[model samples]
Target: MNHEISNQLKQNQDIRENLKFLAENFSGKIVFSTSFGIEDQVITDVIFSQKLSAVEVFTLDTGRLFQETYATWDKTQIQYGQKISAYYPNNKKIEGFINENGINPFYESVNLRKQCCHIRKVEPLQRALKDVKIWITGLRAEHSPNRNELEILQWDEQYELYKYNPLLHWTTEEVKDYVTKKGVPYNVLHDQGFVSIGCAPCTRALKEGEDFRAGRWWWEDTSKKECGLHS
Candidate 1:
């Protein structure tokens, strides 16, 4: 491990204290990406409640988000009194793709789906991570089988930054409890069994015994569910 990661682990600090340490000590810019899910809301609360400076919080507006997601986004800003920057897809690229294929071409094949995701999510994420040295996220280990192998702090070569997952070890129940106790703003779809929220067309509510990630890209193979944002 790097000295900073080692030090932070040694300290055994809480989320806010560790984030404060990163805000003060990390050399380059620090940024957090939120989708306004319950996990992200908890981290947002930590950042805003502690008043951490030098930390930029932003979200990717895929243009296909649910109304509830937008409402939660507004509520988060109002509750924290912080401006969360919004990154959007390249309109030209989206228009070209849609014209060539169709609006919902993602439902046809994996390649088309990945293409839409690249234009809508992965590309915007690249723009968001530009010039950032430390990228904070609300990823939890329990969210997916792939995520279970991720460390709390790891290098993301695609983004060329250190990805920090503050809630890596946290469970869904724990996240919900924290959000409720802290009164953090979250999407109402979560209450309707939406374990993971993403673009409107690709997401749905999970049934009993379903994995947390089952709600996202339910039509795709389990191995190909992610939108390449975290991959």
Candidate 2:
């Protein structure tokens, strides 16, 4: 195998093995966050199939998600019978921020967008990750330019926790095949041209022949496409 693929396989194997180890070693402190996307569904299947311990699944209900996304979240809960905890932005913070900056100030500049993302997603992520030693995410290397070098496992400097991306090595096609074959519940928006789903106002559908992430934050330059969630 090429060095890159070999490294990817090693990392992938490490995450699967480490997840088992952490479930036993850490017992009630591991958590996983999902956004009801295809990638999230694949990871959800791993945890559900393995019956991983202490793995609390959660989602951020930004109150601005597409109705289809919420419907998928509900379907996923019913299919797995595992409660996916919902986190909402603090009402006071959201209201105050919108009042001061206008409802869509994110269109003004990248900084404003990040500030909004911090209020809606980042802060909630911090709270979700609190007391959790291992944080599992649905990040894939193909999702973004910055993520091409990401490993299946790494230490999150900002959160001070061990991060795991079990599906990091899998291609998007493989992810879809697994979800389809396993009958895993996923956001239907993926079929409608949204490769990635975030808040409704900030995300858009990609055009034919566009990059995977071109649909998200499309108004900004391609280099500045991310919300505070990943970076």
Candidate 3:
């Protein structure tokens, strides 16, 4: 299945047609998770603007998002209608962690940080992806060194699903240009140098020479920065 999908993608470089093909073949099993970043906005535009009704679009609300992100999401729904579903962290798990760890224990240790991420992101994602077959994302190759090696389509053993990163080969500049040209509603933080925006407390604007990965978890070592959702 992966090989056939890869060959089909290789044969057609048009993203819209590729997505349409997936929707036609996969039907109701395709789920796309967007974080409302530039790349995600681009993908959202393609899916919504094109009216690919078979693809289910959604977001993971970590409850720590920037106001700009919420505004962008609102604008997007206004523009394209309310097609994006929101999956939030488990309330019980969130309460338990905060009560035991003082609300910000993620700042205290790497293990604690990962634990927080697991509760706030990974666990909620597990629920969103339950019984889902084709898990789509807005991941791009320019984001990190680790992501640069990933193929456009592959099987995820962890979730036992076919993970499809439709924008995997796109450049950062290409993504920015597409969003601008499409008049897509995007988070204004990108213009302010905030790359890869996630939770507000964990994200920051990139400095002059920092890479895409530098904006999030800036205080930690580069090797330990991932929140485990992608890693």
Candidate 4:
């Protein structure tokens, strides 16, 4: 382990011990958001196997998700036998936006993309998190350059809750190995070169030798790629 990381974690203690401590500290009313990706599956397994109580598991149904993603969600529910709650954008809000800007406003500009994401993800995510004290996610430090400096445990000022990333320091290979070894369900698009899966209209498989995140919002500036769902 990097001595710096070891010391940092030692301050909170390592992830394993810290998780138990946090779970006990905030025993009820915590939530974990899953996108049916590999990282999320791994985190889900951890939360379930550890028997964390009152942990609400939820997902955003953008209404434009890939067939593979939806299929994975079904498989995961059966495999885990857990009620993974689904959140959707309000029908009125979606219809109003679509009527005003047409069905695919994301193709026009980054701002519109953010707006769509806000309706489909951020708003619903906030609602799901309303009663939760801790927000668990499958975010990994290596997934994005901007996320490289994130700590395993930190307060999300935007959400005003403790954000936990159990796989913060895990590598892609490590995540894949874990999922494969444990037989966790994940988006099959990953096998076809999609490193990150999101709204169906906005995401695609990365080209050979391309950046891992190039497939997401490919039309926008790579530096400004996020839709603010995870930002």
lDDT of 4 by residue, 41-154 (tens): 887877666666557788999899999999999988788777789999988998999999999999998888889999988888888888677788888876688889788767
Q: Could you arrange the candidates by lDDT from highest to lowest?
A: 1, 3, 2, 4
- lDDT tens readout by residue for model 2, 75-106: 87788777789888999999999999998998
* Candidate 2 all-Cα RMSD: 4.1
What's the TM-score of each model vs. the native? Answer: 0.96, 0.90, 0.96, 0.90
- C-alpha local distance difference test of each model: 0.89, 0.82, 0.87, 0.81
lDDT of 3 by residue, 1-231 (tens): 767877987677788988998998888889899889989988888888779898999888999889999999999999998668999998998998999989778778888888988988999899888888888898888888888778787879889988888899988889989987889889999989998999988899999998888988887885547777776
Q: Give the higher-TM-score candidate: 3 or 4.
A: 3
Q: Candidate 2: which pairs clash?
A: none
Supply the TM-score for candidate 4. Answer: 0.90
Global fold similarity of model 1 (TM-score): 0.96
Candidate 1 segments exceeding 4 Å error: 1-5, 9-13
Instruction: State how far residue 156 of model 3 sits from its true place (Å).
Output: 0.8
Clashing pairs in 3: none
Q: Is candidate 1 or candidate 2 better by lDDT?
A: 1
Clashes of 1: 0
For model 2, the stretches where C-alpha displacement exceeds 4 angstroms are 1-18
> Model 2 — TM-score against the truth?
0.90
